[model samples]
Target: MSDAAWPAPPQGSCTLPASVEAEVAILGAGIHGAALARELTLRGVTCALVDKGEVGGGTSQWSSQLLHGGIRYMLTGDIRQMREGLAERATWARIAPRRCRWEAFWMPHRYWAEGLAHRVGIGLYDHWGAERPGWPAGLSLGHVPKEAFLADPRGVLGPFRGATAYADLMTWDRELTRDLAASSEAMLLDFHEPEGFEQGDGGLKLLHLRDRRDGSARQLRARRWVFALGPWTDGAMAQWFGETRKRLRLSSGIHLWFDAVPGCERPWAIRRPKGRILFVVPRDGLLQVGTTEREVEDGWVPILEAEREELFGALEANLPSLPWREMLVWAEELGVRPLVAATGATTHLSREAVLERHARIPNLTLVLGGKLTTARALMDRLATDLTGLRCEASTTAPLRLWDGQAAEIR
Candidate 1:
């Protein structure tokens, strides 16, 4: 779909005013910043949300677009992350039903032992969200018949024990991010980059912003500031605050798109030799197969020939019968996910958001390591921590986006 099909910005303009003042200045217009703008504006706080590029034009557009409740995280005993994801999934379904729809995710197992573990893990996942209203029930785990499994003959590995199927929500991550930013009362400044900041009187932050279209500059002042730079968190911190100790460990992920697999409408979670999960999602008549996680020295990772070869090998190993070469190579996306720096493989990094308050800068906050699924909850927590305002009542209230579509939370 063309960009025109989605809702336009509420301000209908990205032109920066000469001077603007607000209660908060949010840097980075990705999903996190957009969601924070919505949450803050609803609480009667004026905000200025500035982005170096178009809103959601960065890594937000390159997400897997699954509103899943982190089913894989359950294996690691990350119950809090799983529960937050479940609640956020339901919230997105309520407010953006048109944008979200249910898809059955299949986890095929090659060994009985692995299948048993999968069944037990999925059972726990299903039970965790049982009390949440409007959630899907009756998730089943069973063996797949040989004939049924071979029906598609595309990317389906044979001699498997069985599969576990469960429902998860999917949406257009870019559109949702745009809608949240455009609909908020906050001033959305696209194509504006933050040059630096200066400490102001009464603990106010004076931000210097530059227009990317032209060389013009503007000044913005706010009581509090948030840096939601996503993968650029470390760079922004070093450039602006000059106090960076490597708070985030960046991992690069790549997704390749092809024409929809003939009969593979439902998404599949295929396990790789390294025990990592690769998702093959079908959406909008396109088949998206991805996500290889590897630590990166910087954020400028691209889709190299080795990555393409790896994907082709995966397809050949799993679904040897499918003519993968014949499928149209639609597009490719590369994104960097900020993970908490720790000793382990990049695949084992937690997906939780990290909120760091500057020791010297009292009113400044740095947001890092978050997922698109939990942006709203993360922002709510940040708002409460910064402003001491509670959003208990608004949790059940319908959230209206840029197009004036109300998402009923109840």
Candidate 2:
């Protein structure tokens, strides 16, 4: 495997002050951190949101960009997971309709059994999404005949009886994260790097931080601390706080972007013979094909040639007449998923969020293993845990994002 270096995260334009104090100080300005900060701010709590790089610069910026209802989780018969995702999907669609929209995903099936299974899955999916508060009515599965496939621009080569299409919401994950952070009353410290922390006299944590751009030291005092370090959670605890516990397993996912494939206006979900699913999504004039799931070590970002070839092979295998290998790649992205450490392969590991209080530090909370679709719900729970009061229904499900804008302090 050859190493293809990842582009450095963009330097944040925001600067830090000499010292800051907050009621709740959060580390890691990815989606979860941003979401939690927003949640607290909405509850009239002061928050300091700190990150080592620009906001949304971490794995939050790199995703398939689908607000899906855990379609793959259905394969494992995880109904609860599916329902949770669907509920959150509806919430997001309601709060940020301007930022996301419904899109149809078409999947081709080779055999009668395959088609039947897909039909059943779609039926279940539609049933779960029916009467969701803000989302549109559930859509029935649409079929595409083989004769229609012959005239398609994606150039399907193999013979197939038909295809099934269903609907899911597509979003700009990074932009949504930034909007949440910007709309929050939290003090966003984008380029602040945490060095260490110590206990204060009042049972608070005094966090040592350095400005990445100026190398100037600063301190933040807070009553509670939360680490939403994503893939860096386990190591950050060990390095900064000297706490050692197995908390997360890393899975690497890579996506390749090319100039929009002509006439491929919508996303396609394809299942290989071995049951590996691949997605081809077209967005913002580019076609993104991705996401290989393999166990990887933390802090690994280089794109391996094998990963590129694997994605290319999947596309080529599905659309043989298409020149997938010869096509020029406009860009590439690699993100590591922090899965809950388990005995099975990373592919089967849980995406459910885990909240752990530090063994010794009662006020320190560590968040692990959640996705873009479920971050708001996780943060809502975290907020409730920290505040010891249940959020009203209006504070959640009906709160409009990007509304009630907070003044910019960058």
Off by more than 4 A, model 1 = 1-13, 131-147, 155-161, 201-204, 273-275, 399-410
What's the residue-level lDDT of 214 in candidate 2? 63
lDDT of each: 0.76, 0.77
Model 2 CA RMSD to the hidden true structure, in angstroms: 3.9
lDDT of candidate 2 vs native?
0.77
For model 2, state the Cα shift of residue 78 in Å.
0.8
lDDT digits (tens) for residues 73-150 of candidate 2: 768778898898988888887776666778768777788998889888977886787534444454435666555555
Worst 10 residues of 1 by lDDT: 1-10
Q: What lDDT score is found at residue 17 in candidate 2?
A: 68
lDDT of 1 by residue, 1-410 (tens): 12221233333334657888999999889999998998887787899998877888887888888887887776678888898898788888776665677766888878889888877887777677553345445433344555655675553555454677666788888878977786578887777767877786545468787776666788898889888988777776777667568888988888888887678856888777544778888877788888777788565566778878887777767667667778788998877788877888878888888898877777888898989899988898898887788876345555455553445311
RMSD of 1: 4.6
